[model samples]
Target: MTLFRHFRLLPRLVVAIVLLVMGVQPLAAQQPLTRDTSFTVASALRKARKDNPTITLAQPAFPSTIQAQRNLTYCTVGGRPLQLDIFYPKAKRSRGYPAVLLIHGGGWSSGDRSHHAPMAQQLAAKGYVTVTVEYRLSPEARYPAAVTDLKAAVRWLRTQAGTYPIDTTRIAVWGFSAGGQMSALLGTTNGDAQLEGSACQTSRSSHVQAIIDVDGTLAFIHPESGEGDDSRGLSAATRWFGASKTDQPALWHQAGALNHVTAQTPPILFLNSSVDRMHAGRDDMIKKLDAFGIYHETHVFPKAPHTFPLFNPWFDLTLEHTVAFLAKVFPKRP
Candidate 1:
């Protein structure tokens, strides 16, 4: 009996020693988070910069020979001046070129135009005048505030077309996550008076030539309301709309992009990751698009997580697919 007890104690002591060794081990000995495959955007940017030093945060200097400028304009939302960043491309002819406006996503509480500078620069490099604009976030400005700013940016872009190399008729809007939802709103609810009354009302057309929505939510109604699908928890909607799921079901529905789709909506490219939670809303939006017989494409990637735009392996693939989609949807004039 004593010998058996000693044997059991010996195994326990060995296990304790192993735990101690692991606890004292240097962090360097542990496997690093896969640099190129990190799901976080910051990590991806770090890896991207490591791989290509030229992908810096700074925007490229305007080419002196091409004739270009960087301008900021203030659009009022509930008596506050929200600023926008415009990158005008230089053109040889007097005719304006197509323009693409980008909206950044931060769950409607954070994020700014600077967050999307790299993508805007890429678009500018592709021969399109690009504008990345900032909008008011929640707890300060609520629903329709961000949407209003986006429409104002469009109107402002059109008004400044002569000064900038922008073709008002060929304008397009691109966004990620929350921003994507806003872009979908702009594309589908062009005539909605409540949301478009301010800056968008006077514009000849609030309609965009095309829309690029990246893994954005389209419905406010919880997908799991009835079946205990806790996946549709009210966290995101509550944050953005400032109301509990049970408190304002009607308002939530009204704010949903899927609720606003119509036959006249512009062509769209819906890009999402297979593992993303918002893919359901994206699917709903696609269904609406299908019901309307609207031209659109859906590109879903396997194993890519939500907000994959901020990472590398997936981001690289996203860029390739986006470029191809853009070419297909908005081909350059011959």
Candidate 2:
């Protein structure tokens, strides 16, 4: 009976020996695949949908005079179809316009580009070519993938400059929360060879003229003591880096926007909610920028949540402020 059992296990042992000799490792020796955070984000979307029943997945109603295009398909990020909605002023306007690229935030895991369609259309109506882009989410795609896709989108727009009536020299990036982090990174690390190589190799310029970071995490270095605990929680860093605070310190810092700041960074506009839990490190980023004498403006909205710019009253005010700020920075062509 013992001999019979040994004979039965001989084939398995032979296969293991063959794998070992071929340098093929078992799945157990490899790192487990990361779980997608999109499920949780999808749940939040469902809640938002329920809470705001009137918020249909429809294009913003722009005036007929303005040429608004919806669901203009863009490239796929990691095999997933990504897209952007473009709003352009009519050609008869007799002047080219600056462009604004708006990125939506849902913790880097979820949020459609269309979330900012209304705002984009509003900007377009104000004579700017507005593009809201879609990027890859976490777990499915990891750190730098989102940033790569964003830079790709920028390069794509630059290629279409003449066709879209965009002022390639004056392009600016704007985002809320996680999107803000990406925009800030895009502004600061414009010339980074690693992040900008794959997608933007043909592009000579990576300089975004300005940035608007709304209640976003600017620094990856967390406070020594804070109201929100990093214990078992989801954040942009965790989602992108795929490691806990204790597990991967080096990667966390590498992925941080603060670590990449340089004097060449474009002028920045930072809008924050006074009551937001993540406000501490953003001040550190401002201090770093100030140390470098980089141009910047900041606004703190009292008694508001993290992404207060998305809600009404505050939303209207933010748009107004953004328009005024952009006008001051990138004036319309005469």
**lDDT values for all models:** 0.68, 0.73
How many steric overlaps does candidate 1 have? 1
**Tens-digit lDDT track for model 2 on 2-63?**
64466456786775665677788755557755545452333544554554544333234665
Model 1 vs truth, CA RMSD:
15.5
Error of 2 at 19 (Å): 28
C-alpha root-mean-square deviation, each candidate: 15.5, 8.3
Those runs of model 1 whose alpha carbons end farther than 4 Å from true positions after fitting are: 1-71, 199-204, 222-234
The TM-score measured for candidate 1 stands at: 0.74
